[model samples]
Target chain A: MKVFLKLALFYGIINVFIEESLFNYPEYFPKTKYDFSKNNLSKTKIELGRMLFYDPILSIDSTISCESCHSPYNAFSHTDHRLSHGINDKIGKRNAPPLFNLAWKSSFMRDGAVNHLDMQSLVPITDSLEMGNSLDNLLYKLKKNQKYITMFYEAFGDSTINLDRVLKSISQFELTLISKNSKYDRFRLGEDHFSDQEIRGYELFKKNCSNCHKEPMFTNYKFENNFLDINQVLLDSGRFSITKNSDDFMSFEVPSLRNLSYTYPYMHDGRFSNLFEVLKHYSGPKFNSVSLTEKETIDIISFLLTLNDKEFILNPENKFPVNKLLK
Target chain B: MSNKFEKFAATCGFFFKYFISFLFIFFTYNLFPQENIEFQATFNNEATKLNKNYSIRKYHFNIKKLKFYVSNISYYNRKNDEIFTDEKVYLVDLNNPKSLKIKSQINKKSQLYSFDLGLDSVINVSGSLGGALDPIEGMYWAWQSGYINFKIEWESNMCSNDNNQFIFHLGGYKKPYYNKRTVLVKKRHIHRLIFNLNKFLKKINCDRQMIMSPSLKGENISNLIVKSFEFKK
Candidate 1:
């Protein structure tokens, strides 16, 4: 009896170690691009990250964390607004993108301005129209909060606030925002069946859009000239602005189609309100590139609807950590 | 009553033994040295020389910040023999070559030291903003995906009709634009790989200061810099 108890205790310890080190995602998804080896996730870090995500301490007026624009209910994206609004109702240049499965993205922002996930938050926190707060000032503010001090200590093994710890904590939380248990995922797992319409849509998507919006994760992770006409006022040149290459003129990073239900106001500019508008744009003469076919367009739209993962948006664990924040 | 007391004593003794063993193991792990080393690069302009004719400027470039990961850095001497191996952090000052410092954060761990040298396994070449942060400064180009790795830029006021700006952004990572080459330095007895910046400038044949950014082409003259350096003792 004593031997059995000893064996069980050993097993429990080993299991805990394994669980802490590994993140479990659906097998269909490709390997994550975000280097977890640099940040390394922990329970404490995730909790601290969640708190920071909801806290407005990151902004100048203390009105925005990452969650202000990218809310969980809307699949971590802003709703209705074409351009993202920040502190003092300042309008940003681009749309607030939906945040999910970021571990797979090699680059961030619609333009891929930032290369590493760790440095992505700095752009928003420092952008004049966005948070309008410096890293040093934000650190000073976080230092005053006793709860944050303790939380930071627990997450990073040191309470003395720094940009590295702050960014890492937020990254830890964002990395956990993995959305994979969609209807499509269930069908892939052999545990559930897709409706005839969804199945037909999936076939159409593979033929028309699968080259760019590849399956499993639904993104080729490449920049493409989707043939979007230059908006007259914005005149945004997309990837060309970053690279200064004529070839990259108007090419934008291909966004993931997952959670399309909640993350409406689609595209880099957020010009389209619903899926139908986006489909209409694709069906127009401008998008009549050699790449897409008319029949394939409708089927792709059907497959996009199936990409919505209801369980992810409603997950209580990912919601505003009200109790922790209140404390 | 005596038998029950003895059984309780045995259980208590067993618990104490396991607890002591666990403490020993924990302490042993914590006692070891675990120090992390980091590298930083610095750039400096020594002599700011401005031209009278076209208002073109020249500056002597020096290392501004020297940062690197020396934990896995290996050094090979002239004879290609391994001399030293351990975790060490080094900060190299390009202007003051002799002022090298080695400090130990953790006593039991290896000491971190830096050197002031131009070219080693890693070199810092400034041409593009993206190239400055690359592990190897060899890849510097705007058109291609990867770094050009090595190139030079120079400003000349003597070459053009109105003394127009001269620019030579060399080193191509792709074929057809391929300009990188290895030169054998017989004097140093080391295979000194020289990026022939002069050769590239000759090919372009326009002795004009080349501004790196396309937007700044006519407004400002581009200055390209290269340093002759090696690992020091």
Candidate 2:
């Protein structure tokens, strides 16, 4: 009986490893661009990352966590806020973009500044207007926490918490945030059917928006000049700030059209409060390349909403660990 | 348990002392007089360092920030065939004078070649990395997907805009605009590599000071910065 139990345990471990290796996407979805070979995923690492994501110990004063701005209820994007608020009610310059299906993103942020998801966590941690904490100090705090010490040991053998492990673990949790079960996804797989309006909208989307916002991922991952008149108070030049080239002036990363309903107020600055305003803005003279009628606008918005994955947001795996580590 | 830990710590302390002595002997394994390969990024001369007024391009200037990356520096044997050790990339923040001096390791008799100066395109796209390539260094572009191989910023009376600040953020990792550069020093066999910021600043026009992307103009600026490195006598 003891030998049988040991064999069962070994098989269980193997099953967990196999599940971690899977990208959790449909066959139609392209191969994930994330180089997971560097920081391979495991249940322990993902759990540790989830705890870190929810824990406020990463902040200078331990007042805010990654979940503060990126709440899971709103598709991992905070709702009803244009600009993100960090520690001490400090207002950030741009809106917090939704975090999901990150395995496909080659670059991150509205400005397309950060390339890899692993290093992406550092921006908010060190930003003076954001978390306002240093990496060295944050590591010291993590080392002090006994629970974190055990978690680190479990995830990355021997409990040494450095930049590589911290970033990689967080990435492991983030990579699991794959969203492939939307109404649109089911429609594509022939498991379900789209409404007539949604089908019409999809057609319009292919004709107009697909040039920039490509399929499957709904983004080409390139910076383009959207020609949004610069905000006077918070003057953001988009990608030009990073590149400083005049040609790249007023350019921003083409955001994914997925989960649009949950990720509103729209645009980089969160200017439009709703999809109607966004459609109206695009219909205006700013984007003269394509014009949409009132019915077409509604139809496209209807199709965009079909991309929302309720399962991705409400998944038990992605939620706060209230019953597990926190308790 | 407390009593046991205290006894264990005492034994550890005894071993630590012997470990230090052993390390001293291990480091001095070289029979001949040992030499160190040290590199320093210099500004002006010995009398002048950062935050102090200096003259370059025939104008008064004081650096507010100066950070750049040097990577894959390898030491070659006398035949220049075999490599001693691949030099890990290091970000030299010249503003803090202490960060200027970098001590390197090489085989005793081997002569060193020019260090691979900046991050290559491969290193930029390789996702998250550690040590000097760590994202916390502030050399990586905050928004874009590439590493900023070199960053030089200063305030000068010569500049007219940006509060008289001259800024150069040079990096890119893609076709046509590839930004990572390698500086090869073929001639001098020296123990020190000196980077004189004065030489770089001498060529800069205050009116055209700002460059944040990798372009033809940015490439010229980076090439000039690479030219600033000199081996000490």
Candidate 3:
């Protein structure tokens, strides 16, 4: 009986290790930029991160959370609102970009201000308009919570909670947000086929948008000027604000085109509510080369719809921890 | 013969005393092998204490805080050959007296020493770090990721704002605004690295009292910081 119990315990440990290494992505996806060696994926850590992502306790007044803006059903992006609403109903300057395929991203934020995914949560947590909590205060509150202390001990080896553990655990959950089961992915794998309109749209996309919004992952991960007219109210200069370089004026990160059906309104400011409106802006007088006919615009929209992954959006694993959080 | 014997005995006694003293020093040094590199912040050759009032050439100010990072400290020989390098980053703050002194295992044979005033690009981009490089230290910038190389805040009448405050946070890991400056001291025997702010304060442009981000001004101020270091034997 003693020998059997020891064997079972050893098997459980092996299972945990296997689960940590099981981060599945498509074969066509490029090598991830995130250094997984620093913060290895673990079941406990990912679960802890999911809870933290959904928890409003990260805020000063415990009123706002990451989920408040990034809803799981909407491909982890806020919908309808032109700008992100934070704590105290204070609106932010830029749109809340959807959270997916973060492992491949070299930088975070629309302005490319954050250098690493592990460090990205610090911004929203500390921003006055957003969570509005200082690091010291946040740590203090987490320390006081017995549930967090127990969860932290399970995730890490010890119960001692610090800024690094909190940030890294959140990153582990985000890294798992890979949208690789789209209709486009299936078509690439020869499991599905695209309609004639989608094929024509694919050709048009190859001709025009593929340079910045590349294939496989659907983004080249470069900051480019999309020539959107500056909002007189916001007067926001995108990447220029971070680098302080004149040439980088009004340039924002080229967002991944995956899960577009779930993630809208479009653009950095969420100015366009639909795909046709986004295409209209691209086909405007400023972008003469991208002048698409009305028929061509409709075809492109049809093709973009194929990129949406319902499997990813509705995945039970990606949703809030109902059992854990509620309990 | 007796007089000659007395002379020989006296000579042996003289050499024995010298030998005993040498043995004592060698063992004590080995017991305490850790060498220290002490950083001192001074205003006009006097130690600059936190929240202390300082006046120089019509500028009256009280230093609320002064903290900076010193990283990749290395020792060199007379021929400029690298001897030993301490691959640790230290947060030297005026408020923390113990943090200002960094201990290293450097030999006395080293003729020169050098260290970067800020963290290298590699560390700046590398995810979350603990200890001295921890974000909780208030040295790490959250909105835009990167460590603040040098931070100095003063309550001064020179500022035109409602609150009489002048602040400078200087750091940038990416080019062409990379602000980490290498400071080399030719004398390695002098462990005291003094930051004399007498010249730095006088050169401050009072009109632009606040500089919190990376820019041309941050780069220029970083250069001045490299020049501000004075060695005390």
Candidate 4:
């Protein structure tokens, strides 16, 4: 009996340790806007979501997956492609934004159309240019698969796979993508020191870019009109499409500056291939314009590079689960 | 032998407890009579069946789909005192007979006076709901995160585009374009709440048949939908 009690105590400590490790961000970051109480994070659910994220079965034709455009290597943001490419080589209207630190965001998409992370996947799944699949069709396919059935049962404690469970599980995996291990984070923690150029760049960044981009999380999580002349072809009318308000006509969700090195081909339309173009646009004729010299832009770029979380980008846990997914 | 006997006794006690609770619940449920309130979609005072051709104002069309959400049902007694309220949202689809009827616990003396034509703002932002509110139900708009309050699909020669299709998916939970309307009716119309599409179809401007997104048009149509609801005499 004493041996059994000791074993129970040991098991309890291990369980607590695992649970605590499930979600962890820096203490300096603001409280997450996502209500975790609605769909509490669990290891099984996250693993299931990871499989779903990597699997192409989520698409209508078993061709495109979330990872297809939002590749984990490019900090979960596709590079080279100006606009997101979906099944049948159909081009999406907007760039596939990088996925990280999503819990802090109250809304999703470039237009801030999706009000919740749980519902974000539905947009991509059903969009005719994207996956071109419906929730019912996706659920039907998932239910037919033996692997998904077992995963659903393990994640939800039932084999009955519904739309809510599928969406919630996908969100669980996305919420785990908290990029808080950048060089700037270490600098804040007093573990690292910045060089003279980096320090100057940091100061410049604080002065010019911190208002919309903000701190720690690197985004104020608000929409901004960055003054990219609307593409005559795409003619995307950003947040105005969702809210139908005139003020939001050119406004788009301000993206986070984290993992800038990996996530290139920036902006809503992926018009800028590098940081120089983006800076130039800001310095040009635009609302809330900032005038910056060549040296100032270079210095700011150096500081922005420090926001790249190398550890997060290369983290094997965030990558495809080859072993489990294959099995 | 004693351990086996104790296990058997414990199992029996568990069953006995559940049995007693079940009996109490059964009796309690039977004590109060439940009421059935049904939403019927009608055209010219007749059941509106899907794919049936109807003519109105030189436009001959058949409704391919008609679905709407009826929520926040409240019943009032003679003195206008709130007797019972049902917070459950019912999705009434022309294709599905099972979803047309809503079961509520109400005193026979009470009558439903008013109900919401669509899901409220709270449920709109709640995110990833199950049952009738689930996105798989096809009532949810994928582009914008909100439940479609009402949907109308028609195949008509009046529409100039897309194989002569006229569709209206009216819903917006946000401010300035809030489309959820409160539908009020006479107390006598409680049992069989009717939505006559003849009154609504006459108002549809065939020139702009596609109102898929939330706009002033959707808001205006939502108001017209509220006006279309009438209690059966």
Going through the candidates in order, the fraction of native interface contacts each one reproduces equals: 0.00, 0.65, 0.85, 0.85
Q: Please provide, for model 3 over B1-233, each residue's C-alpha lDDT reduced to its tens digit, 9 standing for 90 to 100.
A: 99999999999999999999999989877854567889998887899998888887676779998999999888898899997888988999999999888997675678888988999999999989888888899998898999999999988776565768888899999888898989988887788999888877767776667788888988888888778888887
Task: Tell me the spans in candidate 1 whose CA falls farther than 4 Å from its real position.
Answer: A1-22, A287-300, B1-76, B79-233
List clashing residue pairs in candidate 2. Answer: A112-B143, A113-B143, A113-B144, A114-B143
* lDDT, candidate 1, A47-72, per-residue tens: 88889989888899998778889999
Per-residue alpha-carbon lDDT of candidate 4 for residues A192-217, written as tens digits (9 for 90 to 100): 98888899999999988999999988
- Per-residue lDDT value at A243 in model 3: 84
> Which one wins by lDDT: 1 or 3?
3
Please state the Cα-based DockQ of model 1 relative to the true two-chain complex. 0.06
| Model 3 segments more than 4 A misplaced | A1-21, B1-32, B159-163
What's model 2's overall lDDT?
A: 0.80
Best by lDDT: 3
Q: What is the lDDT of residue A262 in candidate 2?
A: 90
Tens digit per residue, CA lDDT, model 2, B25-53: 78665442334445565666653356778
Top candidate (DockQ): 4
For candidate 4, write residues B16-74 as lDDT tens digits: 99999999889877876666778888877788889998887687879999899988877
Q: Taking the tens digit of each residue's C-alpha lDDT, what string does model 1 give over B1-233? A: 99999999999999999999999877765674333322112222122122212221242222122221112233334554433443442332222333223332332322322222122222212211222233223222222223332223334433546644443333332223333322212222122122222322333345334433223222121122223222212
Per-residue lDDT over A246-297 for candidate 2, one digit per residue giving the tens place of the 0 to 100 score: 8888899998888888998888899999998988888889888878999999
Clashes of each: 34, 4, 0, 0
